[model samples]
Target: MGGGLPSDARTMVVYFDGNYVDANDAKVSVFDHGLLYGDGIFEGIRIYGGNVFRLDEHLARLELSARALMLAIPQSRAELAAAVCETCRRNNLQDGYIRLVVTRGVGDLGLAPWSCANPTTFIIASKISLYPQEFYDNGLSIVTVPTRRIAPDALPPTIKSLNYLNNILAKIEAKQAGALEAIMLNAQGHIAECTADNVFIVHQGEIITPASSSGALKGITRGTIFDVARDIGVPIREADLTRYDVWCSDECFLTGTGAEVIPVVKLDGRVIGSGKPGPITARVLAGFRQRVLVEGTRI
Candidate 1:
């Protein structure tokens, strides 16, 4: 739901299938199974100040996710990495988000991924933001959704598959509940994550998050926050969390490539610390944003 680079920007470069093309010229077949059955895997990457943040980590996760689903990405890891950078350079992108997708190519209307002869690759680099500028400044209010994240045994949270019906259900629930975001629980009644971002909470003086084993995507932004935690000497742990823990938390936040680190000041009508973004969360968010702009392998 975000727009691409400005018109005056250089020709947007996109790597599709096996060739580089103008972003506007990139297209895929309607018969593609990924469009019909959501058979694909994708990663959302961020670039800042002319540098791509966490390029290696995002690529690694992309490969891991693809492997989990037994989908073959036609290009090697190094090739895909260069493709992403080239796409960014083609767009003259100094700061933006990248969506890298590998889909099951056009095939007969079938449910199986194996029916496809060749995997279709599409890369689109653009700018994105989940919330408006005011939300980050004023903090967010969220609601608990009836839709639970799929248990790991059923869909395995490790695979960032394209099937996102579970997430979409939670988003619908959040809209019905009159909140900006939805808090999804796992089948076991433990806090999992939001519709699109990983969750974290501050208790007493330590940072705690629902473990990846508890059915959350191992988010790149989540990993970066962990590094910041360690660098700042804040104790962090992966544990099982419940609605009660979130209700009593001193601070709460959500992380993703698009959402970044956004503080939640209220949950299900309960106010978080001072009903505002907590000191620790603010510091970590600022630190993480700063890192994105100042460092990374330049394109």
Candidate 2:
């Protein structure tokens, strides 16, 4: 589905399949494998102060995910990058989130993707979000969900594909428990990540995050935060982290394109660092924002 114009000046446009469509008119088939079976990959990108932050890194991850699924992108990397910028320009989006997805196109009800010859590519430039400002300022409380991350050997965590039922289920559990976010444990009962964002902790003046091998996404935001921590003289490390470690952390937070850097003051009924945003977390957030505004590349 596609359209050329928007109902209102603020509605803007989106690129769907091979055509430019009004934001409201962009739609995929009911039988598209991406929707039916989560047979696709996607990326979440952020725009800050009119500039797309770490666009190349997001695209690189997108391509890697596509390749991992053997799903060919309809455009080259350079072409796709330009198209993302063009979509943003057409929409007049400056400070918003971009969701780019590639689906296995329409196919039969069967699970086989071979019948779907062409993959569908769509880019929507729109504002997106996560935790409210109050949550960031006052800090959020999270609970450890019973759900465990998918074993890496089974689904390969590097594939940022659309199979998020696991994450959604955990989110539902968190909501039912009256918590802000859910902390997922690995198969072995160690902390993996939140439903979406990567998890990190600060202890003894050092920042530590769980290794991707522990079933977390190789997060671009996490990588940038690491660099920012180093620049600010906050030593960072990546290693296996357990629920006990999180319980005893001096400070805790989660990182993602949408989540940004949010402080978690409590986990599973335990208070983290006097139950407030710690000094190290605040400083790291400041560094991240500074880098995004000054050093980030424009798209």
Model 2 segments more than 4 A misplaced: 1-10
- lDDT computed for candidate 2: 0.88
- Kindly report the root-mean-square deviation of model 1 from the true structure over all alpha carbons: 2.7
Candidate 2 TM-score, C-alpha based? 0.95
RMSD of each: 2.7, 2.8
Candidate 1 matches the true fold with a TM-score of 0.94
**Clashing residue pair totals per candidate (backbone < 3 A):** 0, 0
Q: Candidates' lDDT values, in order?
A: 0.88, 0.88
Model 1 — which ten-residue stretch has the worst lDDT?
2-11
Number of the top-ranking candidate, with TM-score as the measure: 2
Residue-wise C-alpha lDDT for candidate 1, range 13-122, written one tens digit per residue: 78887788876678778889888988889999999888989888888998998888888889998898898898888787888899999988889886877789999998
Which tens-of-lDDT digit does each residue in 151-219 have in candidate 2?
989898889999999999999999999997999988988778899999999989999998888888999
Candidate that would win on lDDT:
2
Q: Compute each candidate's TM-score over C-alphas.
A: 0.94, 0.95
lDDT of 1: 0.88
